[model samples]
Target: MSGPADDEGSPPPAGYVPAEGRGGFSTLNGPYFHRPGEGELAEQAFFARRRHANGLGLVHGGMLSAFMDGVLAGAVFRGTGKTGVTIHLSIDFLHMARVGEWVMGEARLTRATRDVAFAEGRAYVGGHDVVRCSGIFKLMSRER
Candidate 1:
C-alpha cells in the first residue's frame, strides 16, 4: 500500500503517525494516520495501483469500507482510551475515488458509554465526499 503522494512522491502528512501496530488488516490500507483535529481521526491512502482499484479504475468500495472501519475504531479508542470491537457499520458510498488520488478518512466519536461507542465518519478525495459512515462498537474493557 502507498500513501497519498505528491509530485516528489509519498510522504507522511504533518501531525500524522505511522499506524504501526494496528494489525495486518490495517496495514493494507494505511501508511499514515492523523488526528486532523481533536475528536477526529483520519487515515491517508493512495489508490496507487489497480490492486487498490475496481475494474472501472475507481477505488474499491470494500477498500473504502475497511478504511472507515479503521478510522472509526481509532476515534472510539481515542475517546474511551480502551479497545473496542466492531458491532456494526453502516456506510454510504457517495462518490467514486480514483486511482492516484488521495483518500482521507475522518471520523468522530459521537457518543461513548461505559461499554459502547457510536461514531460517524466520511472519506474524501480532493474535496469530494466519497463515503459517509456510522458505526457501533462494544468497548472491551474499562481499565485504563
Candidate 2:
C-alpha cells in the first residue's frame, strides 16, 4: 500500500483552509476539483434536478458519461500522486438509471506505466450496474 510520503516531491494543496470550508468555498479549493499537485479520487454528486428523461425520466447519456469521466480520472489521481489529463475515455451503457436514483462510480487500476495509467470503471445505481467505462490518463510527473 502507498503510505503518505513526507518527502513527497510537491507540497500539500495550500487551498484547503479548514475555516473557509465551513463558511463557504475555501481559499484552498475543494478536493473535488481538477487541481495539480493533489490527491486522486475526487467525487462530485448529481441530484435529481440534473436528470432528464425519455418522457419517462431517466438520466441522459451525456450526463452519465461525464460522471464516469470524473470517477475514473479520480482513480488515476489516487494511483499516481500527481495531476493527469484524460487522453481518452469509453463508456458502455448497460441499463437506464432512472431519475431520482443515484449512481456511484468507481475506477479500478488496470495497468500503469511511468507516464500513463489504464483504468476501468463502472457506475452503479444502488447494487446494479448502470454504466461501465475504461480509459487512459496521461500523468505528468515532475522529475526531481
Candidate 3:
C-alpha cells in the first residue's frame, strides 16, 4: 500500500484557509490551516513536512504535542472570547502519522471558570487517531 509520504504534493481538503497571525514558535512550526465549524469551533490542519518527522521517519511526538496545545488554546479563545496560557497539558499517543500526511485536529472547551478553562482535543490522519489531549489553561484578560 502507498504510505502517506507518497502523497506529498496533494492539496489540503476543501474549505481550509491559511491561519493568520500565528507568530513566534507557531511561525517556526507552521503555516497551519483552519476551517471554521459550528459555533465556537474550528478544525486545524497541517501537512507534515520532512522537518516535522523524526529520525525514524514518523511525525515527532513533540510536534503532535505542540499542535494539540494550539488546538486546545484555540478552543479556549473561541469558546470564551479570552486568551490563556497552558497551566497543564496531557497527551496520549495512539498511532503514528507519517510525513506528508495531512493531520487535522479538533478541540472543544469542556468547562470554564473565571480563573481557568478546560479543554480536550484529538489529532488524526484520515480516520486514524494520532494523539488525544486535554489541557487546563489559566484564563487571562484580553487587555493583557
Candidate 4:
C-alpha cells in the first residue's frame, strides 16, 4: 500500500477536493477526489499508485473499471438524487495509465425511468483516454 509520501510533489488537478463518505471496497481502493460540476455531478480523480498497478507496472484494468463504475454511479446520483446498484456495466480499455499519473474521470446520466438509470463515462490521463464505460443501475429508494 502507498502512504501520503507517495503523493509528494504530485497533486490532483485544480478545483478538486477529497471525496468523502466512501466506504467498503472504495475505502480500500482509494482516497478518491472530485470536482463539482454542473448540477449534482462531479469530475472524479485518483492518483495512480503502486497498489493500483499490474505486474507490468501499468495501472490495472480492474482498477480503471472500478473507477469508471463510480464515475457512472455518481452521475446517476447527481442527476436523479437516487442511489443505485449496478445491474450491468460495460468497459472498453483504451491506452495505458502508469503509476504516478493522475487519472481523471467524468460521467453523464444518459436516461432514467422509475426504477433504472443509464450512464456513460470515461477515464483519462492527461490528453489520453484510458477507459470508457457505460452502466445500467437499478435505482434504490432514499429510505434504503
Candidate 5:
C-alpha cells in the first residue's frame, strides 16, 4: 500500500501506467511504470520518504540504477516487441535527487542483433539530469 503521497496534486505524467502489482522490485522502487511513446520509453517513480533515500538525504544511487534498468529494459521490449533480460548495465550518476520529487527515466533501443539488443537512457528530476545508463539485453524466445 506504499505509494506517492495522496496530497500531491500532479496527475500521472502522460502515458504512465500504474506500476502496482508488477512484482516485488517494482513495488519497492515503484509504483513505477512506463510511458512508451513514438521514439522512446519513459519510466517514472515518485521518491517516497525513506524507501528511496540514502543517509545524506538524497535519493540513493542504487535506486536510480534500478530505475534505469527498468526504463532501458522497457525500451528494448517496446522497441522490438520482445521480452528481454539485462546482460549488462552501466550507469553514471550525474546529480542528486531529493525525496518527494518525481524522477523520470527515458530510454531508447540503440541496436540489436538476432538475440541481443542495446539501449541507453537518462533519468531526470524535473529538468535536472540525475543518472544516465546503457544496457544490453538478451531477447527471450517468443512465448506462444
Candidate 6:
C-alpha cells in the first residue's frame, strides 16, 4: 500500500460531501447498499466485458485493479459524502474470473477515524471470492 501522498485540501469528487449526520466517521454497509446510480449497482448487473481476457479466457489483472478501485471509491462516496483518494491499495488475485460472470465487490471497513480510513473488500463470483483488496483512503474535507 504505497502511492504519492496528497497534500492537504485536494478535491475529492464532483458530488463530494461529508457523510452528514453519519456519525463522526462512517463505514461500508456491504456491497448492495451503496448503489449511487441506476442499473449497474442496483440492478446487480455485470458492467464490464472490455476487461475480459485475450487468450486463455480469464479476466485481466488491470481489470482486477480497476474493479477494486471502483468498489473502494464507491464505498468512500457512501461513507463520506465526498469522494476519497485511494492513497494505498493492495490487491490479491485469489483465482481466475472469466467474462459473462456476475461478480460483486464489497468493502468491509476495518477502521475509519479522522482523515484516514482502512478497509478491505473481496470480489466474489458465484459466492466464491476471486480477489481481495485492502485499501487506505485519504478522506477530503467537505465544505459546509
How do all the candidates rank in terms of TM-score, highest first? 4, 3, 5, 1, 2, 6
TM-score of each: 0.82, 0.63, 0.90, 0.91, 0.83, 0.62
TM-score of 1: 0.82
Candidate 2's residue-wise lDDT over 51-119, tens digit each? 233455677787777667766766776776555578999998998887555455667657789899888
Worst 10 residues of 3 by lDDT: 1-10
Q: For model 2, what is the alpha-carbon lDDT of residue 116?
A: 93
Clashes of each: 0, 3, 0, 0, 0, 3
Task: Give candidate 6's root-mean-square deviation (CA, Å).
Answer: 13.0
Q: Report the lDDT tens digits of candidate 6 across residue range 2-119.
A: 2222122233334323322332222221112233452223111132242244456576777667667667766665555555678999999898777545455666556667788676
RMSD of 5: 3.2
Candidate 2: regions farther than 4 A off: 1-45, 50-55, 142-144
All models: lDDT?
0.74, 0.58, 0.87, 0.87, 0.77, 0.56
RMSD of each: 3.6, 12.6, 3.5, 2.4, 3.2, 13.0
- Ranked by lDDT, the better of candidates 2 and 5 is 5
Would you list the clashing residue pairs of candidate 3?
A: none
| lDDT per residue as tens, model 1, 47-125 | 3445667878788888888888888887887778877799999999999887776677777789998889998998888
- Distance (Å) between predicted and true CA of 11, model 1? 2.5
Give the clash total for candidate 2: 3
Which pairs of residues clash in candidate 5, taking residues 3 or more apart in a chain or in different chains?
A: none
Candidate number that wins on lDDT, 1 or 4: 4
lDDT of 4 by residue, 1-144 (tens): 566526642776899888888778997888789997667454899988888889887999999998889989999988888997899999999999998889999998999999999999899998999998899999999822
Better of 3 and 4 by TM-score: 4
Model 6 stretches astray by more than 4 angstroms: 1-51
Q: How many backbone clashes does candidate 5 have?
A: 0
